[model samples]
Target: MEESNRIVEKTVHTGQQQQQQQMSSSLPATTPVVNPSNPNLQKKQQHIEDSPIANSLPTDHITDVDEYKPPTAEEIRRLTWKRDLRIIPLVFLFFLFSFLDRVNIGNAKLAGLMDDIKITEDQYNGALSIFFAGYIAFEIPANMMLNKLGPRVWMAILLVVWGTILASMASITTGTQLIVARFFLGVAEAGLLPAIYYYLSVWYTRKEQAQKVSLFLTSLSLSGAVGGLLAYGIVRMDGIHGMGGWQWIFIIEAIPTLVLSIVCFIALPDYPEKTGSTFLTEHERKVLLDMLRADAGPAPENDPEFSWKQFFSVFKDWVVYMYCITVIGVIVCIYSIGMFLPSIVRGMGFTSLNAQAMTVPPYILASITILINGHSAARCGERGLHVVASVLLSVVGYIMLIALQGDSLAGRYVATMLITTGAFSCYGSMGSWFTSNFAGRTKRSIAIATINCAGNLGGVIAGQLYRDNDAPYYIHGHGAALGFACATILFSLILKLLLRRINKKRDGLTGEERATIIAEEKADNLLEKHPDFRYIL
Candidate 1:
């Protein structure tokens, strides 16, 4: 009986050794073995390679198949710098154009778009609100298509379509035609911001993301500044060739987008693994892949097969809904300010051209505040406090707007600067906060789209907030903005406390208890629900 048992054990050992050898032989010839001296690094590398997602990838997609010697920290820094320089600027330019096209209707409105179309104030507000209806409807599907078609092809097509629509707005002579153009314009612009957010999330680590988000989003303010300058210049062309200044605004802004569409097609990188850019060497590519995987764990978008179950799973998380609420509150203020700042300034007694130019300073101040708050939040690794600070600042601004009541032009103008600065600052930190909490790539994509979709309802609210009858005071608008900002602060505090409680509970679990929990999560394919996965507050 003992001899028979030994023979069986020997046979099992031999089979296991053979399987291991077969697996090793399948890898590339130059692939290096994990160092025996560093047990922790070896375990981590094995964990990554043995993950289900990793195993499902094609052999060529595995970064571990390259030489295993990790790059030095300085080398990694240089590679990151090179990657950022190439990627951020191009996407920045694209988003700048996207934002400009979406909101330039405001500039056109001021330059006499409503008069040219003979539209009533109610019809104009309806046109504004209708754009967001198309925008909200198409976000999820557009992001799904973006994943399939690749960013370059998908974004270029979108830009060209929207730019054409914008240019055609110059010819619309009735409110109905303008409304139709605005809706299609919204449809074309839907995927852009969310797609870019997802793209940046894929490229950067959690610690690095807020700063990058700030840089990308600073374009919002920069567009305001540049758009203001451009509007001031273009509106002067009102009488030339019998075209209205509003018509000239649309035509001139549309030209750059059309031209940049061709540039985007040629310039955008698909993904780090699939990029064919001559600028990145094989070593740099491998290092980058390694860094990203280590920092954020496996991304679901990297999975080989599409799962409807995975796509729908994002809706089950309460965190997503909470994020949506906060975003809705923030967007209400932002869209309101974006759409009405010039008018608000004009109501404060500035000339039309001077009002366009005056929009520049507030936007510039907002841009500076966004960068500072984003950098500070990233450095401190605290998202909630930063967001709360920004909201409170806006609350102060709204209060001033209410109390001052156009009594002091300088005071009201300062309030405008505070409003822009405070509201814009929340975007970078808040966006990074929610994005980092999601584990899977598809979930992150859907979460972002859904949040933006829900949040855009704020734009509808914004369109109606400042009525023509309100005129100079607009107390209702100011009060409503103040209410939203306060709501954001409350929501942010609740979320932060909830995350803290959850983290404490996780911290108190025993090793074996945590292990079992992780095993259960893995079995259920719940990536971020693992005991080790802590939410960023």
Candidate 2:
């Protein structure tokens, strides 16, 4: 009776979700990985295989195969929603401090950090922006190593490095000193975001990753809101001896990260395969592994070692490029506003306290925007619409700020919320898009690292975009940010169209033929061919 019920449930749900399993008659005659007419796509693909990109990382070698088997809706939900959610809060809490450590410097400046250090204005700006230089240098290697090292150790180690550096920053007396420390701090923090995304992929299927990405990425918003209160409160505190508020910003915030590091060492699980026999019973382990295997095929445990051919394969994929470009434009809008919003608010004639207070609203809006779109995307198995909407919202926000000259407190306040909401929403949506589009350990890791590395370049540029000369109005900053938002729209359109074309080409095969193609695509594993995986919308 139990076996009969299980069979009935799987059939009913699978038919509802994927009735059109057979490829349609009008599909392309032949769909080759290589194309002649599209140079940019060809170059993007070749770029993955050439020299540094191909040889530089671990994501190139293994893709566990799954056969196309129709999973019941019950099985789909079990893998993605339940498993993906468990690790999200963990990533968010860790990143909360990670972002805080980076941006709280801006908060510190408002609290008179520059004055306390006796630094020139230019030097202070230099210190604030220097972290990106270091961040860009080590991102890929760090992410490559992150999976090999595993999240439990890698994340904690990264936190310790950055958190310790953050604490050490309090002792610096000059701008030069601060810049050097921040540079190293960036190096330490470099792999974390991409690595966490990659790590999250191991546990959750592409179908489940969107909401989880949003949940994890929401830390940036939480950081904005909570960092303000923390920065506002801590900077004002009466501390030991004669240390100022910014000094405490370092010391106080660094402590929690340190505490979490220890907790991470104790509490975090490495992978299901290495089940240590203590935390989860054998039955629970089998259940969890069954869910992942159902969705992603099987996690190939015994495999050939990493190779350049495989590492370069990700670059050839094309999806990563679209993901990277789309994210770069949006992240610029995110960091540009983030880097300058406090200063912009202060420039509008409000005191530092009031300016800080003004930032709170944007973060509130950002938190909700990120989570809602992300959750919807994950639930509906969609990735395209939310990303486009997020960018469109940003375009509106950017146009409003750039086209209109506003000096009123309410006007500047409103602009901040609009830009923040739109930019952060795009960020969350893009993250969901990223994981859903890539498969296999090698491909996903390199894909995430490469995309993030490109996106961080925008951070380097954002530091320069906000000019001191435009202080009273900052028209130049608003215009540049708007331009990037428009670029975001372009990339979004291109990515959506490109993926749609790929989907159409594959649509011609029979259901069984299509399953065979996907199984081969997932790599050589025989087990992964029949999972009935669908493209994350």
Candidate 3:
């Protein structure tokens, strides 16, 4: 039985009320009636339509054919603001702390971390690389678990688990211990980024997604800046308790994540369908549901509540791999910068503490650029061009870093800014692009997890790129970064062309042909290949 049918049948309530609740909780949010063929059932639906709840909803604008004239621009703007207030702040803080904990090792290294741990440069690199081992291995499984357990319970659990692991890092005395802790830290932290992306998709439409995701991606930049400033102050507490500044950075930063775990459990909502009346009024809930369903198109009659076959089918889609390939190089660039920026700045002749401070300006510029790029993409409804432009900028930056003379300090610093801005901006535009292209919920979930897991192989590579032995003008590191950024541009253009070709082919089909394809796919219980569905370019 479909999950929605099972839900309606099992609930011990009046049939009309059960149908009403089911509409609130069900995917597709199809029009609710006890039964279309029964006269009594039709009356029940009419009763609902006449009720105060339905009266306050946008149903007056809904036509008999199930088309709803969406909320006006002003109404959508107001609702979006309300949603932003509820969702963005908490997730933003969660990712901020999560990223800080992950990358503060760069700051810690500046505070004599390797000296205290007594590790060689190769061992330090091994420690960095191993984190992604756990991260990549667990990402898909973690997202699957998230779907099973729901975001609130699973996210809160992950937060606490990763926080405990991060705090434990302060006591490690050997490179192997650091490697082990960092690995588990990756294991515990793996679910966070992909899960948050999926969660945001649940709330926002495609048009709203790029800007919202960019807002969230800003945490990466903010965390970099925040991590640098915090390290500047906290490292000054060195030897206060006979611990190195690196140790203090680990211990102190882990505290906020632990606190936020409680907040996540108490406040983070799961899905629009699952939210209680106190969380969202009936009118607001219905409007939100209508907006989403209208934007995505109504679910087909044969659409299942969930399908394992569809979940696994993402692997068969060639576009999924294209997404994976496009992101791999971008991930390498992002991880390389996040994990090594402070060290890179120090190599530019700044003092250890001053390097931490100097990392702030580039991240600040990148954050601003991300917000602007995101809004522009969302407003213009263009992805490939924005992504190409941003990454092209990074390519230029990498070229400058590799080719500039050693004495050109100002030139090198400017190159870092360009790298940060371009690479960081890619996060939002590219992410929203691929995610919007995938069709069904389960398929999208698996595709996102797969693409992210595959892309994180770049993180493993990043750990090896900028070795301590290759400091100051690390030719190999800058050269590899340049090559990867170029690969991103290449794959992005290719993917864009491929999607456009597919969309153009679909557009050539007649209405009857399109209907036939949808019908056949529905018979197979697949939802992602509707001929009428157009990919976002």
Best by TM-score: 1
Residue-wise C-alpha lDDT for candidate 3, range 348-408, written one tens digit per residue: 8999999999999999999999899988987777899889999988999999998886699
Instruction: Residues 134-248, candidate 1: write the lDDT tens digits.
Output: 9999999998887788778998998899999999999999999988998999899999988888888777766677778888888888888888999999999999999999999
TM-score of 2: 0.81
Candidate 3 residue pairs in backbone clash: none
lDDT of each: 0.80, 0.70, 0.80
* Model 3 CA deviation exceeding 4 Å by range: 1-75, 298-306
lDDT of each residue in 43-160, candidate 2, tens digit only: 6555543422122122222232121122344443443343445566678888888888888888888877888779887787687678888898888889777757877898889888
Q: Each candidate: how many clashes?
A: 0, 19, 0
- Badly placed stretches (over 4 Å) of model 2 are 1-12, 15-86, 238-240, 297-308, 510-522, 525-534
RMSD of each: 9.5, 11.6, 7.8
